[model samples]
Target: MAHSQTEEESDKMGQFDWFGSIGATPEAVRVLNDQPILFTILLIVLVAIILQCVLLWYIHYATLKPEQKVKKEKKKPAKK
Candidate 1:
């Protein structure tokens, strides 16, 4: 007699395959599943740091002195 597929096995293969498809290791996926809150906080902190850096750069750029443009004088036409 042939062995039957279990519902749990079918569900695991259908949805969770994406983790492996995306190159996430089993351990990493397990960690993410196990501690989503910790990872969420860590992600928020990382984004905040990046945003702070970007704002600082924008501030520095905005405070820079404007470049002075030289005006060109048009030459007068010679007398006929």
Candidate 2:
């Protein structure tokens, strides 16, 4: 069956087309439709920042020494 021009164009949409559908703001949708590569790079940088923060936290926690318990002296019963 022959597809309409609009249908053919829609079929050629990039993988990021779904981003324009899920409650994105009009401006965001415009960017996604017009500059998909910029949107993809922005997402990559955002994810990299989040991952770097997580890795730094993991390293900070992993190298920490456990606290040593302090022994308290027991007081003798009161003298008669």
Candidate 3:
């Protein structure tokens, strides 16, 4: 006689499908192998740094400069 499906098998399938007929192909392993994690992280960090530097420069240049201060001349009153 055939046995009914076990709860463990159903639970495992619910969590992760080892034999699911329909699912997206796993890409993490291939992506990791194709591009080294360290290099990818470093590249992202470098891009962030460059973008930050460019942003800082853009903000620094975009700010309005202080207006030229006008000096007023004071006239001395004639002494009696």
Candidates ranked by TM-score: 1, 2, 3
Q: Whole-model Cα lDDT per candidate? A: 0.70, 0.76, 0.57
Question: Candidate 2: which stretches are off by over 4 Å?
Answer: 1-17, 68-80
Instruction: List model 3 lDDT by residue over 1-80, tens digit each.
Output: 65555654344332223313355243433344445675579789999999999999888766847553345779999899
Preferred candidate (TM-score higher): 1 or 2: 1
TM-score of each: 0.54, 0.50, 0.38
Q: List, residue by residue over 1-80, the lDDT tens digit for candidate 2.
A: 99997688567766567765787765565566777798779989999999999999888877777653345889999998
Task: Report model 2's TM-score to 2 decimal places.
Answer: 0.50
Identify the candidate with maximal lDDT. Answer: 2
lDDT of 1 by residue, 1-80 (tens): 65455555435543334666689886666566666786679889999999999999888877877663345889999999
Prediction-by-prediction clash tally: 0, 0, 0
Off by over 4 Å in 3: 1-35, 66-80
